[model samples]
Target: MAPQVDITVFPGNIVNNEFAATTTTRHAINPSTGEALPEVPVSTKDDVDVAVAHARTAFKTWSKVPFAERARLLLAFANAIEENREQLERLLVLEQGKPLGLAKMEFDMGIQWLRTFATMEVKDEVLDDNEDRIITQTFPPLGVCCGIVPWNWPVLLGLGKIGPALITGNTIIIKPSPFTPYCDLKLGEIGMKIFPEGVLQVLSGGDDLGPMLTEHPGIDKISFTGSSDTGKLVMQSCSKTLKRVTLELGGNDPAIICEDADFSVTVPKVATMAFLNSGQICMLVKRVYVHESIYDKFRDAIVEFTKTVVKTGDGFEDGVLVGPLQNSMQYEKVKDMYADIKHQGYKMALEGHAMTNSKGFFITPSIIDNPPEDSRIVVEEPFGPVIPLLKWSDEDDVIERANSLKMGLGASVWSKDLDRADRMARELSAGSVWINSHFDVAPNVPFGGHKWSGIGSEWGMTGLKGYCNSRSIWKWKKVM
Candidate 1:
């Protein structure tokens, strides 16, 4: 039996280990039902000031705490999250509109990230050790950090920033997207019990809240995950104060199906990547370039696989493989793209189901049958359950087309020939390239974008170093 979790009972903004309610509030909509779940506090400039001030105060002591103790506490925090795993998973489904199983997976990924970050340490490097002189390079934490999380994969992405920021001895304030803020607020509520006052906080609000926090002088750094256009805005805002910024933005990642690829195995995987998270993930494969010889077979197989396996409706429904778009803005955007595809008269191999009768913001999972290279569906990211299957004969032309897009977060190659796949993967312009797999990320591996997709990396030593400032120490044995 499933747990009877009531998502409405969650708290609001958390500052200094306490709930900070606001006079103005907004309701978080349940994308599955097209109804409001519960009221989340709409933070104002004063709320931002309070949270930042608390974070600033906490950083003073947090930065001085020993690394071992910080790691221990972080482990304890991860344990606490495990204790409330079921509740968090249920809440995630209600607010984020992902299947309950996917919600659980998100928690699992988040918990692993926290645990891995706890074990990671940025050690000092000895550049020169000699009789006459010794020089070393060390990483020191940057002060108060603000993490702005997106609607999709809120918990996983939220923890992605939180784990590294706190483990590196920096105090952080998280601002979750208003569309799906419940889990983040609940996380903040849970954190208060384990962490010291102001060590970790979450503030929920509408659009204005982001600029309030990003432009504030108190915030030393901004770690943002959102669209490329919005990421550009964030960069501009941070430049006013010259705040350190890490932006993980959009992606139109491509998946190349080589001639040697097995359609039986590759089709299912490519379809899954294209439609996962309702096609909302930044790193999801948005375009597919199939070798001309196998293009027709791969397209037919994928269409059949999607029809047989992909189920959509409310996320809580059993065996639901996809869910509604998390908010109205995105739902409308995807609908517009669908209309455009129709207006262009592109052949749709598989148009799963009509959303007209559905109550929630649902769109039919669709596939374009080898559309024109410059078609809207092929050129722009639909960010919904729609994908373009393009035919490619020349390897160089396909590679060029794949890398032509401005956004390059991730890409994948499907080929049984390991050497061929490796050579092709190396040529693709992306932060993470896979031979046979997609969306394979780990805490120890660095992940980021190569172009407009994002700036700076997340996870691993490189990501961990992003939270700190490098310092070099030079000492002389004798007055040199």
Candidate 2:
């Protein structure tokens, strides 16, 4: 059963700012319990239009603010996020079902990014400085951006887009995933109080709202993080207006364990990487390329490790290893993938399934072993935590197999030899490569993908670039 969200008369910005389209508030549920949460307004297309209009209007004044002042405001926003971390963290856990600790970590990770981008300064450079002529360049914000954030790490991705966009002086309308909207709506309410009305706005509701915002002519850019299929839809919607777009799409990231690698160490880590968040992350190790020599040992260790780590329950419980799948569709997809691979004669070391009579959609930790290289389980990005092991003979062969996918968001190499690991890291096609490590990310570094993983980088200085357009200035000492 879906949880009910209460919509009552609030009679203020939460209502009026909803663009006066609908008065009814919708319930956000705990995916784990199917229980109603404090309701947030479900926005209408009119609300989306109003949010974009407000952002466009705000851009006029916001774009003129000195870079330093803009940075200061972002810093203030970051501080506020840090101060309210506890409240925000709980809200995220309630809606998203990420373990409480992991939820808190995700929140802080985004805060780190906000702080980093806020303090970062764009240094001016003279393009040409010959005695006869000189030229320069400056990076400036695109007027109004529509940020489409995924539900996986809501706050982290939301902050990733909002922090850079605002610090660079672009007013933005954020469209939170309908699966989880309360946190973003709450974020908007607080953000509006901190910044001006038009500086930042949040749109919460059904799928139609995303298309409306992305396709709106007033939007100058679209920053989206979600599945590749949906990313295509977003790009198509933005095509008519030719809005600048940056997409961080799906990934079927591979982890390579060379012959010399220790199965004892790598297996346990791989299980965590594969199953964490119940396998919802784009960069989760969906495919494993292991040498034949240690295959059995590696497989057994991973099964054991998975059994130890996964404890099914609500996300708030301490020592809980796994939580409910974000929604039923995702839950069904994971099961379908499991069945598809099973039909291909792959042996399952572990299989995922939802608990009976449960409020939230759930799946057990699963390990699908040695499916045909061409099987959907191996070829498609199973955003669920089921890992398919593919054995390879050499480094070149492993690299070839890993890069065979249409996606290339992230990958990692696990080997004891530093030289070999680094060599393989250089060969893997990914935006970020982890050597003997799976999921560590930093706000100060750049992350995105090659091929179809994504269109532009996010985080660090590169992330800021996605929100801006470069303007070249030429001062000819002698005019032609």
Candidate 3:
């Protein structure tokens, strides 16, 4: 059953395994119906301090717990989430505006991710093994980890940080985006049963929360997922503390549609990635470079496929594939971009449509045809259900064009030729490149960005190390 719009309210910082409500609060709205959902407390700087202090105190013991015990508890927590998946997923949908199916996927993926991290282990290395001296490396926990989660897929992204942080023996304070704080905060609440007090915490708040987490002395590391502009600010802020930072920022990812591509299979697959979550995903295929010979065919196939599969409505409604955007700030941004497209007379493959006088921030799928290379729709990320298809004649030229963008989070190349696709994938500049796929992330693989997209990574052996500092221990025996 769908949860009530006015479901139970949530408190502020979860410090020491208890909810602490603050004086200030922020109201979360349901984008599908424009109704205000539960109001979550706004954690102030003081609240952040409390959470950080508790995390620091917890680290003393958490970092000392046997790895087997920590992994067992984390796996137990993941199982618990699976048991409570339905209710948690409903909570995510009410706040995040993703369709009920997508929200449930987020919860399910989050649980799998937690288990993956729980099972992940890295072996210590012997730097040197000689008769006279022995030196080895060990992974020791960083004091405290602060995760700043974005709104689009908060459940999956939030747990991305939590799993790695906890498994690596660091206590974490999760600061969920005020736009969609409910599910993440609830995760913190759920974690209390499995984790020790102060091991897991969440601070929901307004503008002040981010700066507090980045600038504070207590936070040892930070993992952020958001816009490139905001990521720069986070990097700048973390510089003062010299804390380890991992940022998964914005992307203008391009997908190369090779001449021999299978349109029947490719069109629907690309359509799903291009417009999934209304194209709010960081790795969505924002640009398409179709071979000139097959450009028209590919474009028409996509348009036809979109017409058949695309349906925008309230998240809970049956047969609704797309839902209203999660917030107004993003809605206005995309709305303005569409205005510019119309003013410039760009040839749109399928014109956009909006809700009729409804307060919902709903926008139908938009496919702009062959916008100029320099146009805003082509250059900047609109982060909406809007995509631009361009023509590419030569693989070399298309490769250059695709790698031209500054954001290199992810990219895809579609082709039946395995050799060609494999070679192209190697040359792509993005951190993750897929052949015949886009935005296909798993818990075991390391996910991150290159260039302006991000620094460092998450969700692998590397990610586990992100939450820890490597220590080299040495022993020298006297000549016996």
Candidate 4:
């Protein structure tokens, strides 16, 4: 029997004020069963205005609070979230359809970001070795920021934006994706307990409330994470106001399995990384490039491994390796891509199979053999359980080919020669390079892309730069 998960709707807050009452109703459906778990109230533009107004007023004082005080409150917020992580994890599993363990791990990592960023010290010092000279670059918040996060990993992504923004002394208004707004709202409530009213807020709705949040002059900066298409739209929207923006966009990450690479090692790791989170992760290995010598063996190994590792079932099951697609649109898209690739003459080493007795959006992991370099599935990101293999022999040739894509988010190299793999990783045109690993993220380490993969970094001291305006201060010293 599938686990029974229930959601309780909490009213979305436009303004971060004391919660007097819950006065709205909307339901978030569990995509696996197609049942509404709980009804969460949707916020409108007026709500966003109210939220921003409160934050704008709060910024006057919040920004003045000593950096130490702000850091203290940030740690407090992290503590509150940590205490209720299991409850948050349960809700995340219900709405997002990721495995329960993965959800919990994500929550933990999100808290780690909060803790790490809270203690980050921005210092000012002398620029020269001169004994009588001084220079400083003090960090200051960008007033009120609007954080727009996607539904895939709402808690973690939201923290990636909010953690830096908040610790830097900026008040925040988060507009969470409608697909999973409950967790955002609940997290906001927990934040309010530690933070002063208006320091943090959550607004929930479809796409309607985005314009007001981004275009509002009161919002000093915007941090967003989602598709490149959406990132473009947001960039245009924020342009008119000329607001500061940070965007973490889409990725079609490619893994190059070299001729000298061990198939036994690369095949299994790439297969798991490709389909982790049901291939919903932006950095998930979307395409695999193998040398022709090992293509056949790599294909067979990946196909066999994917079959055993990924399970087709509702998300609520205990041992389900992969859950439903989280929505019907994604389900159709994955299925369509699989069919298209097969029709384009690529062999379907593994065909995607839908569930026979369930209404949930489940699809089997699929592998396409020797797909053309320019094939639709190879060029485009499926963002689903589909892996299309491409063949390449010359290292120089393949590196040139891999760098061809406009999306330079991430890449991975697999080989027994660590030095060779490291060199390739450095040469790959990507913001992040992994040797023998994929989907590895840490809070202290910066993450972003060079080309269309993203606009700016999202975590670490570098990420804090996005939420701040850098000013170099110098005092002219007179030698009398």
lDDT tens digits, residues 326-435, model 3?
Answer: 89999989899999999999999999876657788999999999989889998999999999999989888889988888989999999999899999999999999999
C-alpha positional error of residue 472 in candidate 3 after TM-score superposition, expressed in Å: 1.9
State candidate 1's TM-score. Answer: 0.98
Give the count of colliding residue pairs in each prediction. Answer: 0, 3, 0, 3
Tens digits of lDDT, candidate 2, 1-480: 111222222222232233333566676678888888765567776776677777777888988888888888787777767766787787888888888878887877887888888787655568988878888987888999878999888888898888888988898878888888766666665565467668887777777878887888999999999988898898899998999999999999999988888777787788778878878899888899888888877878788878876676778999775788887788888888877866777788777665767768877777777878988988888777678887888767889899898889899999889898998899988999999988778777888988878899887778787788898888889878
- Best candidate per TM-score, number? 1
TM-score of each: 0.98, 0.93, 0.97, 0.94
Instruction: State the lDDT of candidate 1 residue by residue for 1-480, as single tens digits.
Output: 212334567556889999898998888888888888888899999999998999999999999899899999888888888888887898899888988988988999999999999999999999999999999999999999999999998999999999999999999999999899998988888788888999999999999999998899999999999999999999999999999999999999999999999877788888888888899898888999999998888888999989989888788888887799888999989988888888888899986444878778887699999989888888888889999999999989999999998989999999999998999999999999998989999999999998899999999999999999999999898984
Off by over 4 Å in 3: 1-7, 477-480
Error of 1 at 205 (Å): 0.6
Query: TM-score of the candidate numbered 3?
Result: 0.97
- By TM-score, the candidates rank as 1, 3, 4, 2
Best by lDDT: 1
Those runs of model 1 whose alpha carbons end farther than 4 Å from true positions after fitting are 1-6, 352-354
Better of 1 and 2 by lDDT: 1
Candidate 1 residue 395 C-alpha distance from true site, Å: 1.2
Instruction: Please state the error at residue 189 of candidate 2 in Å.
Output: 1.6
